[model samples]
Target: MLTDLPIRKIIHIDMDAFYASVEQMDNPDLKGKPIAVGGGGKRGVISAASYEARKFGVKSAMSGNLAAKLCPDLIFVKTNFDRYIEISKKIRKIFFDYTDLVEPLSLDEAYLDVTKNKKGNPSASKIAEEIRARILNEIGLTASAGISINKFIAKVASDYNKPNGQKTVNPEEVIAFLEQLDIRKFYGVGKVTAEKMYQKGIFTGLDLKQKSIDYLDKHFGKSGHYYYHVVRGIHNSEVKPNRIRKSLAAERTFSENLSSEVFMLEKLEQIANEVSRRLNKSKVAGKTVTLKIKYSDFTLQTRSKTLPYFISDRNILLETAKDLLFQETLNNSVRLLGISISNLNIELSKKSEQKSVSVQLKFEF
Candidate 1:
């Protein structure tokens, strides 16, 4: 089974404070200044903060009120997702030039399987350098990259050098790299899982490697199987290109809290229509429809209903969203409304997909 697994060269590219960086590049006055991209009101949450703002404890998802207290001079710039999306497409184009085996985690980060690249470059390190350099030269932005044998290590190494740097973990150094990594730093280990591992004396990768698979299975259940191999630098997940989007959604925050269910239903209708339009444009339908509601007190609630058949009809989506909205009693006045559809069938027409793609040669582990 081990010999059947493939050995791959993976590179993870991540933009540093992407939104904030974009803001700085557009407005020279904001350069080197502490800034955040998001609403900066009493109830607003930050979407991203510049490196300068980070020193003041301002971070993404932090409440605007708290961020203000952390840094009095923190400038809050409203998020321009349209602009960000445009920039992201350009970056993806650059990745495609090197290899089509690229998986975007978000607009700011992606994983590339560059073992066999279009440039025929044997060195993955050199490819990463060229990619980063092109981004800086053409796009006027900086990116950091990590190179390794798998996704997990590549992701972790990408964070080792921030702002503008890259790290490569050679095949021979994989074991030592994993052994010395902190448990908290390992991918998939969240706060609760980290605390649980620390309680069990599993503070580092080495400590985690010492546990028997059966012992870990007893304590951690299904995740035990994953940790058992990750600790030994063994991850066989493939870099899937053109990954299907799981869901599509549209949401809007009201300037004032709404009290009437009739007004709320009207908002849901518009949101559902937008979601329907997006679904059709993508040529995908979903079985699950989710309604997300945010109350005036900043509390959020989500309700979903799965249909027996896939649908992209506006009427069906609006009716379903209305049902989900009225199914539960309003605990408080609503401040935001959103509608999303998931469990998508994203198989596109054969003619739409690009042809003559180069296939990467697989290597036995």
Candidate 2:
């Protein structure tokens, strides 16, 4: 029997080529150029490539040498994580003005539940449009948005319209939309999985839905249940506001690999600033500070220190990060540097505590 479910409203917002876009927004010289933000060494990887760079087959995670080969004229830029986090905070604040039910996936993307929004607007589509416009107006960066009845469809819909576009999928249109979508576009299906599905003759949602639960389970394991419902447009995930944060981190791959301590320290300071900003924004304090370094051989190493007290201060974080970096000996030229805050505290107010107690007593009576 088909269960009647209450209509939900979800929005997914994704920033296009986030790091590259931020660099372009800050420097007019970089605008309209094929830009790649990453290490330019033999083993260095591309962190983020601009849309122009993508046109030439450059992509994130691609080896820096291959990226340069793909687009010889590609301009590489050092990542400025501090600037990106600042912009992310402004964007998050814009989302909070509409609904508190915001779940950040990364610095560039998030899911928002606006089923019962502060705006009192009946249409989620209108709210998404307004949010996109506000982001452009306030942050000077373009963002694409998707509005739908659930997270699955909303995330897919957001990508339908590229760079500064909005797309919406109403509940009624869900099935037809999924029917035509490529198997690769499905959320959990990566390149390897899609290739496997193709070998099994499962090319579309209909093909996937036609397979028996037993058959799917035999192939995909426990995630088969998720695939079964997703193909049928039966997602029931909720927008949880009180999400526990597992990790907070900021990392940057340089435009050029460096062996110099002076140059590395400059970049480390910026990463530390970003990590601090993110911790402050989430109202989290971390007891551990970790430093990650990736060498030109693609080898990675990490050093971490747990502090006596939880901290979110920029200077303290930077100093700790600097110390960790100094302790490590650079075997090969360093390509990437990262700082992460591990332990977190979800802050609640003492004043709100008394109010909550009073409300509970009133309800009891």
Candidate 3:
């Protein structure tokens, strides 16, 4: 379907081990060493791991004890979100120089529609290269990029070469590149979906292409149509700027599980205060409150209530969370507690629709 001569040029930019890399860039001692951020205690979980640590099976979300076991020399550093945010702003400013059509997915990654960039560059790949160069020279950090016909393929290609590298999946090569792609490599297919697809004999993009839209829909539900089109190189999602957060949440994973609801109440208050602080910082308020509960056995549960009006005051958030906590009986000892506010006022603000443009191919990598 992407064969329609005229197509949009998209680029996916991803920073490399951002938090850990920043720590290393600031501290010479951390460079070239196995280091992890935010896993300093006996029960602590890693937020990010340096590439050196990654070689020893260390990774984000892994337990500190396990990481220490994997790499005895692994050093743990506390998270500095303020510093990360400062640096992220600088990176985003760099993006605005090349294009106003930038969509930041997180602090460390973004998508750019450079078909009509401020730089007036015809080759999206060149823009990506120059952007990566600026990030390294100006920010003292390395970044990788994927340039292609759409967000999905570009996102997939971005991972092909990582840590100070770039990949460009030109228009003509989109089909065969996607056909030979591993099902696990599809942008939206997570581990669970990949395994489910694998069980159904959908191992590669080509295999997925073999199934008719009906068969895919019968097996995969709503995502079936999504897969059918993407495998044929047909993702058309546009890069949206000023992306707003749908929900704001604060969660705490305890060093030890609490056996009583009374103990959780105190923790819930702390989480609610954090949620409120974040809400005020973002200048947003929500009408829906949700409480997340994670059991020691790894099972998870959520409870929510919609209010008559939006509220972001710490006391109100605490009260709403307290109500949700008691709405249901506890299933097991709780290891994690989270409070979130949703249906925010900012979501009500509308963004202008992006106009689609099609023209004969006029650029090359």
Query: Using TM-score as the measure, which candidate wins?
Result: 3
What's the number of clashes in each of the models?
0, 0, 0
Candidate 3 lDDT score relative to the true structure: 0.90
Off by over 4 Å in 1: 1-5, 253-260, 294-300, 331-336, 347-365
Task: Give a tens-digit lDDT track for model 1, residues 50-153.
Answer: 99999999999898889999999999999999999999999999999999999999999999999888999888889999999999999999999999878988
TM-score against truth, every candidate: 0.88, 0.72, 0.95
Give residue 16's error in model 2 in angstroms. Answer: 1.3
lDDT of 3 by residue, 18-58 (tens): 99999999999999999999988867999999999999999
List where candidate 2 sits over 4 angstroms from the true fold.
1-3, 247-365
Task: For residues 1-365, write the lDDT of model 2, one tens digit per residue.
Answer: 01233367899999989999999999999999999997466557778999999999999988888988889999988878888999999999999999999999889999999988999987888998899889888888999988877788899889898988988877667788888888988988999989999999999998998998889999989988888888887776766666668679999877778997788988988998899898888888988999999897889999999999999999999999988888957788988999998866655423321111111111100
Top candidate on lDDT is 3
Clash pairs for candidate 3 = none
Whole-model Cα lDDT per candidate? Answer: 0.89, 0.85, 0.90
